[model samples]
Target: MKRERGHFSGSVAVIGGHDHVHALRRLCEEYPDIKWQAVVLPPDSTPCLFLHEDQSMPEGSFRIQNDINENTPTKVDIIGGPFSGIIYAVEELISQGGSDKARMALPSETLEDTPGLTYRTFWTWDHSTNWELSQIGQQEIGVFNPYGKPPGGFLRDYKRCVDFCSKNRIAAIVIYGFLRDSHGGVEAAKELCSYAKERGVRILPGIAIGSYGGVYWEGDNQYNLATWLRKNPQAAATLEKGVGFQICDLAFPLNFPRSDYTLSACPSAPETMAWMEEGVSWLCETFEIGGINIEAGDYGVCGCSRCVARRANEKEAARRRDVHGDYWSHTDMADNFPRLFNAARKARPDTWIYSEIQWDNLLDPVSLEAQRRLPVGGIYQHTTNRTYWKRISAELTKSYVEELPMQPNVLRCQFACQWNGDERTERYALNAPVFAEMAQLSYRTGMKGLTIWGEPSPWYATVELSYLAFARFSWDPSLQYEEFMSRDVAPLFGGMEAAEKFVIAANEIDANQRLPLERLEALQRVCLEHRTSGEVGRRWLSLEEIISRRIYMGE
Candidate 1:
């Protein structure tokens, strides 16, 4: 079949394994008019894209070769490891545009690349930023629940998240408050898990071991932690009469004004351990989840006699080892998490078992011992407290990997979170440079994953660019930030010059810097000049609105 001088038409044959073929199939779904077929090898009768799974290729690696210009039907060969690489290749096929136009965009080049990390993840709170945000939505500090009619509305929002992650090559997304009645309960959650899996993304449901209402958050299920604790008050932690968490920290205090979930279960209680194990097992068996992110409630530590005794013992041991004082919940975690981790591992042996370590520095003897005792395959996650991250930024080294309990370690940071003040004032903050540095740091320290808050919709320019930077840099930390903005993200804003202007304005907005009225007007003019009539054009128009709003509101 001979194609036109500038455009290519007709069917595109996709040949690959089940997963690879499925990835291509989904990409083709949007183009209903285009005929696509699954075959064993490249067929000469039509244009073919062959995805060959090469076992020898290292993890997170892929190679693409295009024979489009030379061949009559136009051919492309994508050889790589599984899912991720396949997704990347097919995404590139449609990078310029989708459907028949995507075929025309195919370039004659040989490219090989690999992800810097094995697991690139995004974390979010389901009841908060994960859903859509609106002007009339609940403006409560951290809560932003923008749900529509019923099950369909909630599920659609989640599917959008999964779609965003899959397209960006993000391997996993951790959803806090995964089970909620308003969101269609267990059935909807199960459906989402299955859907994400098909798209090469994992949906990790966030579960608190002794708080946050267990596996079924807000569900009237037997395993709800709050329900279980209420029924068995003896298992509840005994804090002093008027004692509660103090709002000492600069950021966390603002995010959690009501930090008084002091009704935490006693870590040393036998009943608490049994209940956690049972609840976790039920959750794992019930849903087809990618994995569970278990946290031993960060609200407050149990002050019951048994718990106090355990903490005292841990403190003594920590002192003797000359690594004391920074225990801060590490003792509680060591007491409560082992059995829970084991139960999760037993239920889902092949899936990722994430242990959420609240503190970044695990220098305390109790935390170190706990790390040593945990299962090897577990993904030990360390939180990047703003203050802690700043202080320890220079101290990290490849040797830091040795401090971790497992090979695959992930760093979690906040983006667009109220407690995280970086982009709190204006959501349109350009955070690519921040994430690029994070990716390089994580990759250098032998960490396998880098996670940031992903509750914001990617449709927003800043959020989309932030997600793009996270995906690109985490996949290949070697990518230069400026080049990435120019080569990858610039196209959406018309070109590199326009993109730079957008980036500058966005970053200033994020920093809460005041822009002069004239500057705002100039930005609007730029947006009008280079705007296209497509999605790319829409992004520029969106920026124009933001600038227009700033000028009108005089903020």
Candidate 2:
């Protein structure tokens, strides 16, 4: 067969195991014009891209080798230990196909890539109510409802998000605010879970144990916790102003003023422990999920008399101090977390369990000890731009992995963009470079995954860019930021010239918090002139408008 001069024209065949058949099919679908065939490998020589397992490749590692010569027909080999590697290899091929190089026949090249982190996960808060921000003193805090249903429905938007992640080869998708609070309810979550499973994506449902939302709060009776609290109201946690048993941290003075009086269940309470086990068991049984994210309590745990005593015990306190150093603290909830984790593990032995450790408590001895005791496989830690604790957190994660029998994975989380009250404000912060650095640093440490948190909002250009950069850097941290911007980001903004101007303006505004009126106007004009008619173009236009308006106002 005569091969085309500058396109994938001649007959091309893909051969792989059952696990990689879908990936091969996808590749064929991506280039419909190209004559593509899927076949099984024979004992004799067959010119094809062969996907095979290689013990030498580490977990989530893959290598692509293009062996094209004059005598031999075009043949590419993708070798990896996991199915995800196959997906990644196919994705790389598709990317190369889009370039001019791939048009001139498969370029003879050998490239090996591996994920720095074991699990690159992304989490959704679910509902709009969860994102409501309230002013508490100087800080504006929002209610974090991890299990709330996503606003404006779930299916269509969620499917789009899953598709993006699947294409990018993200490891997992975690949905919080499931069951009661979810917009479409359990059926929607189940459907989403099934969809993710089909796409080689793991789904983990968030289950809050210590903190119960108002949905479970029945007037004066707070579900199961109310029944226990009625018998011993003193067992409830004592809040800032000594309010008895708050519903959860979300109901604190800022976000949920109505529920401000409600207190979190005391971790030391036997009833609370029993309730946690029952809740975890019920959640596990209800969903066919890969795992459950066990939330110990939002904010801090109970400081009730009984809880205080448990936290104050000298022997336990000393042990905590030894493990956590100056960062150690005694919280009964820390001790109580193990019980909840154990209960969940007992209920679902095969399921993977992990916890979201708040940044403030990352080094807390009680939480660290509980993390060690729990049958959990990983810890999810998050940070904003302020990451002074990053090095310490990484060290602590390394120490825990070394000391423990089962090395737990550490998944670092960061926001793609901050959600200001107005959705437009989200575009103000474009920290791709900063986030990429953090991902690289975390990878160098013992961290196994990076989770970029954001809503599936359509107008979020900066968010999408941040996510793209994060995914790329997580897979290969050695990739430079400027290279990514020039090669990957520039394409989104029409071309390299426009992308460079947009990036420069964005960086200037990000650094100085504002741009000169003339500079702002010039960039806005440039963006307006070069803007395309898609989402990326719209985002650039929107950002330009924001900058122009701000500069004109002279605020």
Candidate 3:
């Protein structure tokens, strides 16, 4: 690792807004003559991707020009987690100025002179039930009521999810319930819990907190927690008293208004910590809630007082933005959980805690190798399978498990969901074997159990596939990531090869192994590519797409 960093001039230009360009830029400045650019390479060199990134191509890296020489790497097919990271770097690295349509449209130069690591990540988020992959934001089907509208829904839709979990061998089913806008649903929670218990799905029910839409509600905020508690009186009274342990999901809606959420709960700040402590105390002791999750991880918008107070402890903390920035972060909310837990523990003891990691600590390679042992009793890293951008690399989701910590008790392989982004598509988001591998890691990490996200069983075949895949993996991490994809898929989709291939291609595109991307791209260009092909491959792809409505940008 040191060699790689040193060889890359010991300057890593992290792009894609990971934290911000400042931190990376400072690193570049610290190391003289070390150039940094957005162009990144694979963890190890693979001929297929190497060919794609070949600089001899007329338009290289930034943007590929169609007019370029045919042999000149026409396209640098990206396959992995760092596409977003790399692109952000490239956008910043290039001398800012307008150029020819060709140049402007596509950065037509090699970043040879710019020597540093540029990492970006791209993947699909299957937000569908067993029916189809839907859309994001308002376009998403279950955005408002995924678990269902209760009585009828809790029984029907949730059962669909439970069935999927059983069928898939999902490690655990995570239903992030709690509408911040609505009175946090107790009746709904009770019913949902009842349904899960009946179906026998290992579940961890938590709240999206600031999410439903992740944002600081001024109307809600205006009440100044104290005021709100005063208004509510009951909920507030619950806070003044602290508990033993409390769990805070870094704040839901990582993408902010896009995810329709914001506001980070800093556990380190005095007031913030105190306030958070109150919430933790009330929830942990009163609500008897200690174990929880933060699928997206910690409260990263540290510009606030608590974060600033904690800043002095961190050597690099000074570099983070002082102004409020995006509310998303790979932050370990467990760090703050301690302060809150201390406050709570002061109130009560014997509290178990949990937090979820989103995107596997953003390629730190630490969590991938070993997890930081925080007060967080368990860390539910979201290994949700969404293989949307496999053209860059396949089996990327499985990368979450390898570097797991040796824990006493943790539900390490808490597989979130299977439906990648709303609906299922040819794009293989959650490869079965990835979950299997994660399950292995979880088992090894002394994980307590597994949990799949809510609402798995639905109309989509992908959901069925997800449930089946999860089931297989949770029990056997040794299972091959692509094991039985064809045979397995065939039986699910009325025994069609085209459908199997479509699914295979989706995973393969990102698997970035064995197959060439151009060939992969040609494999399932889109729903149309399969619309007429007689091969079972084309037909299956079309059927799944028709059900999902998702389009693959490239192989």
Candidate 4:
């Protein structure tokens, strides 16, 4: 039964914890006409959202109840647990009724929903490519860029990203290069973490155990790894002669030129381990960070006598080769990261700790054995190796995943970044189907979440659709792709009619297939048709620019 528009009379009452109520209060500011009032006690007459306040409500679930009675004011009793779920419930209401002071129709229904994964997340580089900073000079395109600029616009961009994540119900964002002098360093990170916390988002700073600049990325701060390495040069990794991590890749030499950010300490060095322990401890102590994402440098392993001797047997048994065709020992990662994970766990017992596993093969004996020894609750992040995902996609199954460790895991893929050396068209291409595949795999395997590059703003149609796909499937992996595109995605563009037209042109551009002159004309026609002036209008324009650029490149 549908309650007619204007049936909502009384203000909506919100009952929950202080943090959730505060968040809801802030959310309601946007919908001024839909009155939302925070209440200490549940009201009998008005609509209420009982956020984690109802005893019968189970964990990771939300319930919405609406009864048909046209005569009485429309009342919706939404009961949900966790801050994100509460936000999601409100969003559902808005989508069902309307938003931005539009007439809302509350209908009769009972809907229950919950997220498929507990830890849906995104990965970003703070000092490099996540934002469009003013004049940073050659350092704005890659991770761990050394140059510094005022946090000004960069921080604002980060806040906007957090807002996007919060709206989409993404639980966390792992930010590398999170600490910098221009960004106010530790104080700034603490503040930003607090901001994310308010919106039910975790800002996990990327901590490199042996590289990527300690707790802080690049700064004169005492906690920086470079600062410690300067004093104890012997602690630095002794790389093989003429070998260093290279950032150059397909078209990246010119398009995304960047120096190697690897400046790692020897994992076996006692001084280095001690320094890392202290740095991680300091980071946990000083900030209110929700978690830590730690990694050993992805480049060459330390060639020091002690380091080489420790991995001799493990490296021999593991015949896996990296992109360079050199012996890349998972044993090296296995040996070093567990200690760091232990350090982080000891420092902050409650925070989530993610240990990076940089290869696609999860069945490798050396790495598999090491995974069992990791802290029980720690999350192992398995990153895809370039195009190896194609094979993984073909062969993946729940039975196969069961052969690996049972601890929580997250699938990390480099779809658009320079690391993606596959044939898939990068940059503006919409890889929603690929994201859907990953989400489904994660769900079937009982993995906690998945991570993708979150630097691109959603204004880019490809990136917008990517974010939408990730958010939609990550929450409910069972949702079909076509339904997601029509029901969830189309609303952003205006409606189904406009969205269908946009998809016809966008798909051609994304596949790198040559678009005939008619398609370009169609894109131009849509742009003109939807040029009413707003965010939706800007989306159409942004998409047009991408398609036009491809045409000009003749690719």
Q: Which is the leading candidate under lDDT?
A: 4
Model 1 CA deviation exceeding 4 Å by range: 1-21, 30-34, 39-60, 63-83, 96-111, 130-151, 240-262, 313-328, 360-366, 403-406, 422-427, 513-533, 544-554
Give the per-residue lDDT digits (tens) of candidate 1, residues 1-555: 444232234687777745565566655665545566777776767887777777676544778776655547777788876545676666665664344633445544567777788878888776544344432232323422333244455576678888888777888888877887777888898898888876768788887767666777765677776677768888876642332332223334433333323346666778888988898888888887777888776554555677666666555434323542232366666666677778777887756778777654533234565556666677878777566666446777778676566446777764344445532343356677778888888888887788787766766777788889989999889989878977888877777887887777666656654678887787778778867788887777767777788889875
Q: Please give the CA lDDT of all the candidate structures.
A: 0.68, 0.57, 0.36, 0.69
TM-score of every prediction relative to native = 0.83, 0.73, 0.46, 0.86
Tell how far residue 39 is off in model 3, in angstroms.
69
User: Model 2: per-residue lDDT, tens digit, 448-497?
Assistant: 66666645443445555777777788877778988898877887877788
- How do these models rank on lDDT, best leading? 4, 1, 2, 3
Give me candidate 1's TM-score against the actual structure. 0.83
TM-score of 2: 0.73
TM-score order of candidates, best first?
Answer: 4, 1, 2, 3
- Candidate 4 wrong stretches, greater than 4 Å: 1-8, 42-49, 53-60, 65-79, 100-107, 129-140, 147-149, 241-261, 314-329, 363-366, 421-425, 513-532, 550-555
Query: What's the true lDDT of residue 436 in model 2?
Result: 83
Clashes of each: 2, 18, 91, 0
